[model samples]
Target: SSPLDPRYTFENFVEGASNRLALAAARQVADGSASGVKFNPLYIHSSVGQGKTHLLQALTHRLKAEHPEMRVLYLTAEHFMYRFVQSLQTQSALAFKEALRTIDLLVIDDMQFLHGKQIQQEFCHTVNTLIDGARQVIVAADRPPVELETMDERVRSRLSGGLLIEIGAPDAATRRSIIERRIALTAQHMPGFSVPDDVIDFIVRNVTTSGRDLEGAVTRLAGHNQLTGLTLSLTMAETTLKDLIRVTDTRRVKIEDIQRVVSKHYNVSKQDLLSSRRTRSIVWPRQIAMYLAKSLTLRSLPEIGRRFGGRDHTTVLHAVRKVEEMIGSDEALTQEIEVLKRMLEA
Candidate 1:
């Protein structure tokens, strides 16, 4: 049986600006437009804990519901390799290929796992066969196809050949909606349980990482609400989610630590950040590290710049001020930087 999670259906999915476009495209594919298999291999990319798995599983469930007669295969890249290897061990390699090729719809989650030479060839063959047969295919990964460094050019090109969609980090309003939906879902099992609007807003403002963190926040709040035998309030939320919300939870962050964290979170090389790669990718994360280095450390702008590629004090000061100004006005940027800060502190 397919490992599709029923809880991840479209009904339970809370649509927001961040995921609206991806959700719509997934819907169009799920409904099977007569215009033909237009968006073959719908590649959805996003950061970890963001709803890639949810959307992939939701599409599988919808396809199974709409067309029961269609043969649908939903599995991760690891599981696919497992099955393929099993078929070889069991002397059913040909049968395995036949089964994979004949499916009406094929969906693979975490496509980044299809990186090795042999595995990429096998998976690429399967995808090519399916696409040639007019069968719909969908894949999800943490980065875009072009950014998949481990994958070969042939497979990477094929993955990018399809419509690529990137799901951005959820904004504050989206986080609030997610919390509300999570609360409603929890109420189904824990009747008479609820979180106050203020608490939800507090969580929405504070827990700005991912949907998974939002789920954790609600779970903790509900548990606390039950223990206290009263509504969850702002005060309780502040105390209960203390570690989650507090950016200063850890000791003073070192300049080295800030650079490593910012580089990793932004998926850029640490040396690139220290180097003079003024490209948007390198510059943004460098500025973020500069900002964090200033805010979280007692070091001055000149000191921070000295640590970061021996840049001028004015550069570090500008970076700090820029991040501060963006955090105030840019809701999405604020959420992203907040998540990075929280991850670093934790």
Candidate 2:
């Protein structure tokens, strides 16, 4: 049987600007109409707990419902590795390969963990064969295909030649809806176990990490109420979730954190941001890091400058101003900065 989660269907998946494109793409793939080949190998990517797995499983569910006779397989990259090795040990490698090739729809999750040279080659072959035979394939990873640095180049290129959709972090409104949904679901099991508006706002404001964290907050609160018979209050939530809040609080964000996140997000290096290079790629990330340092941290201009390649305070000021000006005009830059901020805060 496939390892699909029954709770993660499209009906329950929350919709927002962050995940709309991913959801739409997933729906189109599930429909498997004339456009099936157009999105043959749909690649959905996002940071952990941003609903990447949920969307993949939702599509798997819909595909199974629409084509009951069709074969569907959902497994993680790690599990795939295990099964491949097991088949080899049991002298059933050919059977494993045959079973995999016959699947009508293949959904692979956590593909970033799909390591090992032989495993990736097999994966690439399976993907190419299935796609060539007009079967559906869907994969999800923490980052885009290009960022799967350890995977085979051929595999990356093959996945890249499909519909790539990124599910960004949920904004405030989306976060609010997620929290309320979690609370409502919890109340279904435990009568009158509700979070007050003020408490909900506090959780939404504090847990700026991911929907998974928001769900954890609600679960934690519900657990406390069930055991302690305590009424949910803002103060109680503050005290109970202080550990979660402390980690994601923006006030605690540091320059090094900004540098690391910016470097990874842009595929640049922390050293590159600190280097004297003047290339557009390097300069843009440096300016963004500097701007984030000024906004998120309390370091003085000179202090921040000292940390980032020991430049002058004036440079930091210029970067802050430059980013501020762009935020008003450059919509992409605005979103990029927002994503970085969420990463740092999380």
Alpha-carbon lDDT, every model: 0.82, 0.87
Q: For candidate 1, what is the lDDT? A: 0.82
lDDT of 2 by residue, 168-273 (tens): 7789999999998888899999999888899998988888878888888999999999999989999899999988776553434767788998899889999989
What total of clashing residue pairs does each candidate reach?
0, 0
Compare the candidates by TM-score and give the number of the best one: 2
> Cα deviation in Å at residue 176, candidate 1?
1.7
Score candidate 2 by lDDT.
0.87
Lowest summed-lDDT stretch of 10 residues in model 2?
245-254
- Model 1 Cα lDDT, one tens digit per residue, 1-346: 3477779988888899999989998888778762336688788988666798998888778888888998888889888888888898999988988998998888889887764687778888998999988888889987788756568788899988888888876899899889999999999989988887788878888987678778888999889877878777798889889877643322235567888888888899989999988899889889989998877766667767778998999999888898899999999999998887777665
Cα TM-score of candidate 1: 0.72
RMSD of 2: 9.7
TM-score of each: 0.72, 0.74
List residue ranges in candidate 2 displaced over 4 A.
249-346
lDDT of 2 at 295: 87
Model 1: runs farther than 4 Å from truth?
34-37, 246-346
